[model samples]
Target chain A: MKNNIVEKIWQQHVVHRQAGFPDVLRIDFALLHEVTSAQAFAMIERKNLSVQNPEHFLATIDHSIPTRKNRHEIYDKTAKNQIELLRKNCQNHGIPLCDLDSSHQGIVHVVGPELGITQPGMTLVCGDSHTATHGAFGSLAFGIGTSTLAHVFAAGAILMKQPKVMRVHFNGQLPANTYAKDMIMYLIAQIGIGGATGHVIEYTGEAVTALSMEQRMTLCNMSIECGAIAGLVAPDETTFAYIKDRPYAPKGQQWETAKSYWQSLSSDAGCRYDQTIELDITDLQPQVSWGTNPEQSIAINQVIPFSNKTKESLDYVKLKSAQSIAGLTIDWAFVGSCTNGRIEDLRVVADILAGHKIAKQVTMYIVPGSEQVMHQAQKEGLDTIFTEAGAEFRMPGCSMCLGMNDDKVPPGSRCISSTNRNFIGRQGTGSITHLASPATVAFSALAGFITSSYAEQQPQKEAS
Target chain B: MNTAIKQIKGLCAPMMIDDIDTDIIIPAQYLTQTSKDGYGQYAFSRLKQADADFVLNQQKYQTAKILIAGDNFGCGSSREHAVWAIQELGFQAIIAPSFADIFSNNARKNGLVLIDQPLEICELLAAAAQQNDLIISIDLVNAVFKTDQQTFPFVINPFFQHCITEGQDELDYLCSHLSEIKAHHQNAKGQTIFLAGAGVAQ
Candidate 1:
């Protein structure tokens, strides 16, 4: 059989061949972070085994380090210890680390592409689920467990089964108010969370091609939400241009060599997929998750699906059937995360909230994915708009996206979040979350309900 | 790399928390594509109001390998990072009443054992892990977990269990059949060639 992209990559990196249903593939890159690496490094010490491939391994500290200040001692002691442990582990093993103060230091997913460390046609492994984010560059990246982390440390390889491939083709132009975040959410809602189970989806179609590199990353970033192992876009000029000047990207003559190789990473024209899902971007609108799962979503102007009409698969979301979501009250509004916390997303939110103030009942928070993004937003005075609009501009970190760090919605509160996943207590214990794009989140914050910026902006258009 | 199988042993603290989604397990904000470096540092870093109060923050539990969690542990989005973070944080097996269906499957696929035990047993194991040296023995060959206080039998879908016991991976398993896979292709190629020749003759 002609090798697919996945098979070709697998063959290139094969260190050992064995017969069986479950195959252990050696890994090429092993990414680490402070939160999960501390224990793995300690385990290595306990085992007295040195990392087998320090060159292929990389580390960065992002999770616990407060994005608010770059000061070294500002983080809580435990956060400090975690960072310290990662530093010690990387130093001892001779593995390079991007400490918080480094320009390269940021959200692991964002830093990888920004530095050009996440290249196309490579297999990448990290302890973060958003590792799928790298698939935007056509790399086969996924997350692994700490034990697997140790195994990779000791052996520079992991055992993985080849998953079936699913092709999601986006055929038309996305509307103005629609973004990649909305596009993916619409697909998830249609296919259900487990629709892509055991499959790696390859996104195609004109709309996907038209997306900016950052937007493409956002599309791939949430593939995990729909139970996909990874999501990838075929490499093109857009991909090459984005990586051309990245710090770790090949330079000079090697740049040409790398570009040529990336160009060839696309699937053969007739390559067959196990499943195919086609979507029309023109028909899609800004989407938001009204229930717990990413799949339980609808357009902003729509009502919550009535439970009686929902498939059995959607019962877990606990959403009331037939409830109009347009005016649903909210307690919090969050705009950040690796998924939608980039500068572009912030720009969109700022545009929507420019002269408006957040409703009194709504407590809005904006977290940039990286310090770089934070600084860029501040430079553009977006931070002022957020604060003046009654939104708190907090330091960079995962924050309320997860109940981690200092930001969390109190239990029983309803929040409209720009982050992916509205799973039960995703924001906090007993907190209800609705996932929306940054623009929709901003609009909702101002209205104190789940509404659309398009509708709010309608009045301005009429006035003009 | 050593091919010899190494035995892993130590106290197991199964988290009592149930349905520990990926976000909570390793929040979404931390899911950046930076080198997988330093991720262990932020594992569960957000759970603590004061970082010191986090469950994994205590020095005594730092090295614990056995995690006892509640039902549907590792539920929500399927980011392998939850497994990576858990594994990177030194956990070998997660003993729970149950697991998020997908996470349990992925954990096994990635070589992290998910031990599903009775709720009572899981709670007891978690308590022991919190208080004293709660050493839990994981016999991959037997596919069983034994603690001084109790013996629990867990199921590893046969295919995955075989991979762990033999220290093999899924890719290795698939590659072993490369010759057979290649032969199948060769036969198909031969048939195509023969058909082309026959058509020309006709």
Candidate 2:
């Protein structure tokens, strides 16, 4: 039987399989964060199960950690307790931890690739859903709940029923000013939130191939947003080049052997998928969410229409159909998350704000995904650009993504954010969030409303 | 880890809204609570707040141990709290037209039975849930739910069905194959960075 890249990786990792039962798959790496790991650790303790392969796992304090100016104190009692529990749990289990002060500290997904802990042809599991971001390296990565995390902790494996393979081919060049974030948002809007519910989506074609590894990670990061178990791009020269010289990646002769192995991991010729979808993006536009969900997106140039679900979302968001979001004004513009907080996202925001100033009416927050990202931005003067432009350059953490920490969108205030997921009150109690690419968020920050980068990027001659 | 879910018989409430995401099942605000104990009161709290007479809050359906929901139920986020909330609210099983993959997996691992029925049957059940005299009885061994006037069968993954009936957690079963797991690692080539070739472990 011919297998796609997903099946190939699945077959390589499946330790045992039986008819009508889920395959027992080995986990190459298991990641944990402060928010979800405590319960799993408690469960492991209750069962008296020691961490089976402690070396194979890594823990980080990301969610529920404050990004505020206070260097150390976590004001929220719940956040402080969760972080403390994670530290205690990691110490008890002898697992490596990237605490808040560590150089490796960052969002779990960001730190994984940065430390070279993520690699091709491996099965990665994390308690957080954005673990799919690792699939950019041609790995099978998906989120597991606390119970499943404990299962992996005890056995270093997980039981999984194989998902059907679906290939989404983006077969054209994107117009200027569009980014990978737009590509994913557009795809999600085309296929409703439940479109890829049971399929492992493999994104292919010219548009997907043109995206850098960091951009590809952004694409995979939102796979869960649109209901995919995992999304991946086949490893190629870009993938190999990106992995080279990373901290945890194999070096020297090991690198050569790994490169050869990765080269052979693509889909076989004439591979058949359970389903294939071809999207032509020759005229794709920068996408922005107008309603309450990630799938409730429209082109920045398009009007918010009263679709079947729009009335309910609009009522919550306090928006009316036909009202242009461009000059609607916003209270917040956040630029970070597991989805778009990578250095590349930071550089885009910096590049946009180089000579410009953030609108006085809007309060923009620029957060790097990891400690490395922070240092890199400082070295590159991106932090200076943002700070001088009136945006607050904050510490590395999952800031305002789900509003677990000190940074939160005030109630009833509208925000244009680069983070994925615009679920009702996700950013805070009674807060309204609109999702967009980092470029769009940056541009909107300057406009003090939800505006598209395309208008900003129009040729000066044409604009004049 | 209490996986025993042999038979469940009780009144069920119908939430006919499509794409009922996990956030609505239990909001993100309630997730940070240290204990999983009080999630029951917050289950469908959004709907209860939105519509005062929501089915889950109704006096008759307050103790519903089964839920008949719309298509594509449990469709957002990988939060296991969705399952805990539903389970804490005394729902033993959820019968739906379909379920999101991760949510369904979480439900099974936590011993909450997920029954997949066709859209027509689900709609029928949803209507049946509105009938005050109707009681829903789920027979997992046979994979069917019985009402006074009708019998609708559902398809459950065989292994999940076995686990539900036998009260076996998947982790316990997987860990029992410790020898096999160790041998798998031992048989692999040195440097387990990536499982390189196509050969199965001896």
Best by DockQ: 2
Q: Which stretches of candidate 2 lie over 4 Å from their true place?
A: A454-464, B1-3, B131-133, B189-202
Alpha-carbon local distance difference test for all models: 0.72, 0.83
Q: Write the per-residue lDDT of candidate 1 for residues B1-202, one digit (tens) a residue.
A: 1132234577766467644567667665565422343556667764643246556767778788878787657756545567777888888877787665457656775577877688988877777777887898888677777777666677766667666777765444443444444343344322211111111100
Residue pairs with clashing backbones, model 2: none
TM-score of 2: 0.95
Put down candidate 1 lDDT per residue, A20-123, tens digits, no spaces. Answer: 53455656566777765665676567667678647667787666666455446644666666677788888899888877666656677876776677787777
Cα distance off (Å), candidate 1, residue A332: 1.6
Task: Tell me the lDDT of model 2 at A459.
Answer: 17
Using Cα atoms with residue i matched to residue i, what is each candidate's TM-score against the true structure?
0.74, 0.95
Model 2, residue A106: C-alpha shift (Å): 0.8
Grade the docking of candidate 2. Answer: acceptable
After superposition on all C-alphas, the RMSD of every candidate to the true structure, in Å, is 10.9, 4.2
**lDDT tens readout by residue for model 2, A8-49:** 988877899999989988887898887777778877788888
